[model samples]
Target: MVHLRNRKNNYSGILIAISLVIMITVVSLVFKQIFLNRNNENEQNSVLYIQLLNKAMPVINGINYNDEVDTEENISIKGQLLKLIGIDIRNPFSVIGKEISMFTIGTEDSSENNKVVKRTLFKINPFDVNDKQINKSGQDTGDTENLELPNRNVKVNDPKLKEKLDNSKPQVLIYHTHTTESYSPYANYNTSHKKNVCSVGDSLAYNLETEYGISTIHDTTLHNAIFINSYHRSRVTVNKYLKKYKDFKLIIDIHRDGMPSGNVSALKERTTMKMNGENVAKMMFVLPKKNPHLSKNLAVSKKLEKISNKLFPGFCRGIDLHFNFGSVYFNQDLSNNALLIEVGSQYNSVKEADNTGKYLARIIAEYLHSKK
Candidate 1:
């Protein structure tokens, strides 16, 4: 009986030791788990803090959108979450590609030279960007246009419309009556219609005839009328010249546009035309839809298109057809060869705008040669 009791005590002691070892092991495991969990939580918070701080940091700018001349560029955006992260919010389409094409009307810098400079971006203006008053009178009343653009309300002037006859080689007769008196209706603006009139008109005719040997007859008398807009002049000038010169191949009328140096669409883009294997000044070719004579404008526009397409692949931006207004005659009614060109704006210096005229002469010379 004594031996059995001693064995029982030894068994009890072994059981107690085993229980203590198990309890110590479980406690160690719990402590280790708690410490590991705390460490992970602290690391996660630190990472979150770093991310937030980086986001709140100000952005550093490199380079800027220059207005003088432009280069084609691109950036991509795929997520709407970028707005919350301080991304640009102006154009959602720009995230995919440039929202405003080369010809979007009403650019920030609208001067003639500057407008020409901006056109290299898209190779052509995406919108019609018409500067000339469009003629919609002949439409069947079933036409509609939806533009993905800004500045839709302003009138579009034709940058391609001829503004001057380069020199005496192509003499022009000025029958202008809307002479601006010395009145500053708006502060700092000279509202004189004939500002730089003599220089622009005389020089243009001289240059064209001298450079290309093309004779231009300047008929200053338009039914003895002096005050005329492009639309009225279209009727007056085109008819008189058409009757006088039956053999003149080209009838060109010159006019200038009035827009802020930077807001007019005519000069925001630069054009480079390859003549004599060199990139020379760029000029746009235009067609009017509203002239009382549509056939004449269409014929001349088509000819210009043919010459341009052959001489310049992407040089001719396009022919615009305005569907709103209509007139009885533009000089185009005079000849199938009639053309209107807009030189650089008044904001551009004479030298800059004249460069465009010189280039046009060169193109015309080449076109005649090709025809011969």
Candidate 2:
């Protein structure tokens, strides 16, 4: 009986030790979580947070196109939230996690001015081996010095396009997937890497209508609350939105690039144009291969690139072909008139890029008028 009782007591002691260990673990986890929420909140307001808010940066720390997060609109909301909570957001891990959850939880602006985001939808870009490159510029991109090309007038709009009944009224679709959600009034610029596109596109549309006697319609297919968005996908959506207007022949998708920027020199550049006292925006045509729909006829894109070269000299960037069409066919397949233009690299000022749009608008208008 004494031996049996001793064994029973030992077993009870073991149970107590196990329970104590488990309780300590739970307490440690909870305590750590509390410190994280408290100290990290201040971290949210720092550069790391500003980075998360940057629209121009597509991937950070190699995290991109997360299914749970709508990177398009995560910035301003995160910024505002962090600001309110006194969070500095200095930690990369915290910034990445917060951005990932922003889309997962579907945070959006609830306002009438921000209606565009509510109207548009986004496709999720999966993480694919094909998507990542240890080096994005790739090998033998060669001295960008090879950028010069001869200019020509290879009509860029749809061959079916005609002079509008009112040539003075030039219209356009000013859009961004991230732009759908409005954290505040547009008085504050929206966070989007495509800002160069936005600024250039707007300037062109305005000039076409105001200076040239064109009817201008600035429309957005996706309501302002759009969380997840891509340029190619948004371009396709814009074409469908303008289908009712048969005269809408020119479909241009404006974009900004991530290349390092400085002076542009070309072996073939011979002409220059100025807008608002700044050199006008320069352009390159983008073509897509592998499409069920019509490919961005390489012939058509190359022809326009050459024409831009001829007129403006060093203005034309080389023709670009990419398979990363993203989720958007870019509706270039919709008409031979469609174009995907990269206005400037991300580092450029919106003012410097403005001239490209104005110059292109003139080219396009002349091309349309000359058709007859």
TM-score per candidate, chains pooled: 0.41, 0.46
Kindly state the number of residue pairs that clash in model 1: 57
Model 2 error, position 352 (Å): 0.7
TM-score between model 2 and native: 0.46
Over 4 Å off in model 1, which ranges?
1-201, 219-230, 258-267, 270-282, 290-296, 305-317, 323-326
Query: Please, what is the whole-model Cα lDDT of each candidate in the order they appear?
Result: 0.40, 0.46
Ten consecutive residues with minimal summed lDDT in candidate 2?
A: 180-189
Instruction: Quote the positional error of residue 9 for candidate 1 in Å.
Output: 99
lDDT of model 2 at residue 54?
57
- lDDT by residue (259-345, candidate 2, tens digit) is 311222321121223433444445676665654444435654665665566655556766665444434544566665566676654
Q: Which candidate number maximizes TM-score?
A: 2
